[model samples]
Target: DVKVTQSSRYLVKRTGEKVFLECVQDMDHENMFWYRQDPGLGLRLIYFSYDVKMKEKGDIPEGYSVSREKKERFSLILESASTNQTSMYLCASSLLGLWATEQYFGPGTRLTVT
Candidate 1:
């Protein structure tokens, strides 16, 4: 079974603090993605990596960045936490070149910035 794990299930931080959210996939997938879920806006892509050491900025990458140093690991970094940035962060992985393949998701991390 494809398993995706997140470093934390919940996080709380004060404004301006740096936050790191880590994700790892057991499957040897080539595409990993980071997304933030908001009430009205729904799930918005934050960043994604198609290959190790290759990343692409998503819709809301202004306050966030990502790293994919290893094939199974992907990390999301919030440079400066803010109230508006507080949301449920999700990580997903899928096999490369297989558009129809299901993407496995990790348990989302709910972050609250005070």
Candidate 2:
């Protein structure tokens, strides 16, 4: 079965530390996305990559960056973590063609910055 997995389910970091969140999909999807879920903000996209080594900034890409070295892997990097960035980070993957509407979401990584 195809699955999307995150490197960590829970993470805690200092206010100024750098954080790396990794996501991998076994489905060979061409599109991968990073989103953060906050209480009132719902799901805000941080970054998305359509193909390997190609990334695009999403709705909320201020403090975050993304890397896509391989087709099945996508990484989200927080240069300097802050308390305000603390939230549940979600990763999703979908096909790029007509079925692009369907996305498979990872379990999520809840990051806490103290």
Candidate 3:
């Protein structure tokens, strides 16, 4: 089975603090993504990389960025954490061009900005 690992299970930060979240996948999926899951908003994409060193901004890219230096690793960086940014961040990966490509998600990192 494919595995995706997140760096933190929970995090607490002050408003305006810079934060970094890491993700690693065992499967060599071509598509990688970072999303913030909010109560009502659901999973809103932050960024995704289709290939190593190549990235594209997703729907909700504000306040966040991503890095894909290797096929197995992807990182999400929050330039400045905010109170409204308190949410569960999920990392996912999928195989490109698969008709029913379902994203495999990590356990998620719940961040609370105070």
Task: Report lDDT (CA) for all predictions.
Answer: 0.94, 0.96, 0.93
- List TM-score per model, in order: 0.96, 0.97, 0.95
Over 4 Å off in model 1, which ranges? Answer: none
Q: Candidate 3's error at 56, in angstroms?
A: 0.6
Q: Which stretches of candidate 3 lie over 4 Å from their true place?
A: 98-100
Residues 1-114 of candidate 3: C-alpha lDDT, one tens digit per residue: 989999999999999898999999999999999999998888999999999999999998988888889998999998888898899999999988859479999999999999
User: Superposing every Cα of model 2 onto the true structure, what RMSD results?
Assistant: 0.8
lDDT of 1 by residue, 1-114 (tens): 889999999999999999999999998999999999999898999999999999999998998989999999999999999999989999999998856477889999999999
Ranking by lDDT: 2, 1, 3
- Candidate 3 lDDT score relative to the true structure: 0.93
Q: Is candidate 1 or candidate 2 better by lDDT?
A: 2
Model 1 pairs in collision: none
Candidate 3: which pairs clash?
none
lDDT of 2 by residue, 21-110 (tens): 999999999999999999988999999999999999999999998899999999999999999999999999999998569889999999
Error of 2 at 84 (Å): 0.4
Q: Give the TM-score of candidate 2.
A: 0.97
